[model samples]
Target: MEQSKTNQFNVLAEKPVGSLLMQYAIPAIVAMAASSVYNIIDGIFIGQGVGAEAIMGLALTGPLMSLTAAFGAMVGVGAATLMSVKLGQKDYGTAQKILGNVVIMNLTLGIVLGLLLLVFINPILRFFGASDVTLPYARNFMSIILVGNVVTHMYLGLNALLRSTNRPQKAMCATIGTVVLNCILAPIFIFVLGWGIRGAATATIMAQMIMLTWQLRLFSNKDELIHLNRSIIKLDVKIVKESLLVGLPQFLINLCACLVAAMMTRSLTTYGGDMAVGAFGICNRFILFIVMVVIGLNQGMQPIAGYNFGARRYDRVLGVLNKALIFGSVITLTGFVIGVFFPTPFVSVFAKDSPQLIKMSAHALSCMVMMFPIVGIQIVSTAFFQSIGYAPKSIFLSLTRQLIFLVPAIFILPHLYADPLEGLWHAAPVADGLASVLAITLLVLQVKKFKKQMQAPVENMHTPL
Candidate 1:
């Protein structure tokens, strides 16, 4: 195990930056892309098998889902970030302890929150923009999902830890495994068994539970550097604080996403009605897939940047950052061109029979991605801060896009426009453009800071030491 750890460090710390990124990023990209496809497929199935309002129901659940992930990310991202740095510093024992704490945290938070959500499901959905037409579908779907929330949290948190511990391939496999299984089972449950929207949610949680079983077996192996152990299973206050501090950025990002989603959904409900919210769902899936690919790039960069930063290898950290930023830009740009030229085809995949749905979704898709390319820089810069343990900056960057820019745009843009929904559609690109500018400013300052640290005296470099 020690020898294995040493080899992992040598590769992460000394390998050619480009080659290492390719090795790490491809699996991660594939995994994130697959996860994105899982969502797109869900929209397709629900739109076709259930109805347009079912899609609206599914869309209304977006905020609640984001809230669920917010809690999971709080522990998962924090522990993974800490583990990356600890591994870079050669503190394997503490890293392992963090692994145990992550499990405890996920399990505890998942079950408690899941039960609470179940109790307050209806009121919550109503507040999240569920209407009379969509409330039943949302209620049925959310009930199943909340009941299995622990499985979802455990699987997702463990996957993040897997990547941090030099097991990106395993993490990739787990995600792809769920994607494939969900693809097969979703149709059967929805169409064959006639389970309606609940079938889609059921397929989702079941897939997560199965993949989680695989992850648990891998973590149970005592040969692994970070594995289940009785000694570290109990939570420590210090570890908990550190994990929450580091993870809070991602948690808040998702929390803010939930807030933004609720606002958008409510706005769509008020102005455009259920069908309009359904259109937003289709556009969101396409945009999310693009964003997920960028997240894949960020995941690829995280451990490399975190590890090298901890080892005082500032050049490698910067190298990884530069490459990730460029790659993220390319991904978003591709989405831009496609969104501009092929909006109809993209929206049609979700609602071929509904012309109004297609028209609204196509408009949303084009307007929402007008400044898409800049978004790559924003996302990568936020991840860069989180990777280097600059939690406050990361949190600020994350919130800037969702709360600082997007939320206000959603509200104000509508009143400024003759057609209120047009403003809502335009809000996304406005947020993207503003957030990208903020990212550039903050990242420029951070790069200068990195350079100074690079030039510092041997003992003065900011490192885990």
Candidate 2:
């Protein structure tokens, strides 16, 4: 039994850094893809079930949803990275302590946030550009989503912890189970049950609830090193500080996206109407899916980098980074090609016969994906900085893309062109280009610092890797 337990850790950990990275990435990719299915399913069914108007309503709320996710990713991922390093160093006690802190933190976040969101849902949706036609739909959807916040946060946040433990298969299982449950229940809620917009949100919540149960069961069953204990809920100020130090950068990153997205939505509604909002929704959803590909690589790299860093195998971090960059570039290029060449169908795959939505979405698609390659670089760099505990660098790199670049583009690009119609569209590509430039810049600086540090003459050799 002792040997079996040892073999288990070695399973994901023992492989060459290259193969192990891919092994880790594929499961993460699948889980993310499956998660995207929830969006796709909701969009397709909502577009057909109610109408394009309702689709726009649903779309209007995307930014807030994405905003909340930033917290989950921040806390969950930050804690996971910390835990993985501890686990690798054989400090299971510290690892479990961090794990406990993460669960408590995420749980507290969801409840406080859910209540706050419930109180402010209307004003928030309005700020996001909800129109008279779309307001009801957005309200219904956002209400259910806020009410279901616990499932969404706990399910996803815990999965990151699970991933850090090297249980990618279990991680994959929980994610897939959620998607499967959503698939079965969504259509029923949307049509058969006559729940409409609320139904889509309900189905998604149910799926997440199911996934959370399965994930909880895994920890309870055995063979797991880091399990959440009832006594672990006491807030350790040190652990909280550490988790915030680790997670805040990620939180700010997503928060920036939310801010930019809100600007986009409000502008789209003001200048274009429900149609533009719907189109941008599809554009944002597609981009989210594309980002997932990069995020998967980050997920794969997180554990490897953290583990090897803990083991004092700094060379392995470089190895993982190299592989991640190459793989991420390929995925980004493929997504860009698909977005540029086949954008019409990409929109139509999720949308129905609405010509206005199709046209607007196609336009949004071409411009939205303009920075696909930058997205890949940004994700990898964020993971690299996080893995090495350069939390400030990670946070800054993550923020500059959307906050510094995208926000400026949103305002400046609209005015740069004389035509008012140009106001709405120019932000997409301009922001993409600017964000990409920022991401690449940060990445280069990090690389330079890393090289200079490692290249310095040492007792052994002076080479980095």
Candidate 3:
């Protein structure tokens, strides 16, 4: 398909949204899954080479990393949502203003937050459940991530706009470049140079720099649609407000996930030990990977949903959601089943000589995989709610799995069991199961309402005159 003109309104109007969406989604999904390789590589290299403590060491930074990344994603998703709606409405000038504001906001925010992180990282790590043994490794790793936070922020935040513009392959290429670079450099730094945790962080920064460089090149291309002209390069109050309306729901969701990671860290440390934290860290990484399929659908459908709704094409939105939900269900079945029935193979991929990590990870991964289908439904439903501007519904559905359901379980489950540590391991999966049920119920009701509205008889023009 040829690209549309920068100011064109007929882009989506010319084709079925599903047709355009499929062209974009396959690559977007691949991009996210490829990006997951970065984590998998980091785990394999560090877990095997530096030992289980290395996994715990890096895991120490997971929540804080999540918090910072959540803010970055919030800005990106908010801006992209607004931009897509504007594009759908054929308001090119307003769309440009939004593009400018997103760039300004994310970069400025990234720099400010990065500096603060650099200053207080050690203190934050201790607060996140780091022990004397894990402190050095965590601090070194975090300090490096903070130093390059700006690059990571821009690459991720700006990449959202690429997808919103229906340029999925470009987005995928950007991620591929970074992950490939990271994979190559990680082993060199970790084993060849003997840099340990610091090496992993350094390797990540190296990859991020490559990604950032590629992203900047895209903005500079003169032939591009929606090129960043200097005239519209300032914040617009109206666009910012609208963007926040869509974006804040997702922002809150990510922020809640960060809270979940933090709370998991604190609780795992108390009931289990460094080993449990290590196991939890490994479990969560795989969880994120498994969920990426549903995430791919949510992300791919978000712009399509928002755009279709903006164009008042209500039925198109419903159609997109239908296909996406079915796809998400299939992906959930594949990833979760493998993690459940064949835990040894999956964990063995990231495992080394640590029998403790293997046992603990197998136990944790099996429990976590139990709720996969439900969580898949929750993920897609939350995305649907956010895409359609049901912000409160989105926020509630987003937080329930992690915060409302999981956190409370973490607190109460341990007390009920003879082995409190087993309760600790059960927190996330238990929450996932309950939350999935609630999400499914709400989704079915909402879909029925949409159907009712769609099929409601039009008022007879000349009835009973």
User: On a 0 to 1 TM-score scale, where does candidate 2 land against the true structure?
Assistant: 0.93
Each prediction's RMSD to truth: 1.2, 2.8, 4.0
- Residue 153 Cα positional deviation in candidate 1, in Å, after optimal superposition: 0.6
Give lDDT tens digits, candidate 2, residues 14-107.
6789989988889998888888767787788898888887888988888898788887877887788787777667777777788778778889
TM-score for all predictions? 0.98, 0.93, 0.93
Ranking by TM-score: 1, 2, 3
Clashing pairs in 1: none
Tens digits of per-residue lDDT, candidate 3, 1-465, equal 124465444555556767766766787788888878678878889888787787887888888887887778778887887767777766667776776787787788788999998898878898889999998989988888888888888888778888777676788888888889899999999999999888999999989888878777786665766667787678787777767777777777777777777777888899888988888888777777767656766778877877776666667778888878887877887877887888776676565777777898888788777777656777888888877777777888877777888889989999998988888777877887888899889988888876665676544111100
Error of 3 at 59 (Å): 1.4
Backbone clashes in model 2: 0
How well does model 2 score by local distance difference test?
A: 0.79
| Candidate 2: residue pairs that collide | none
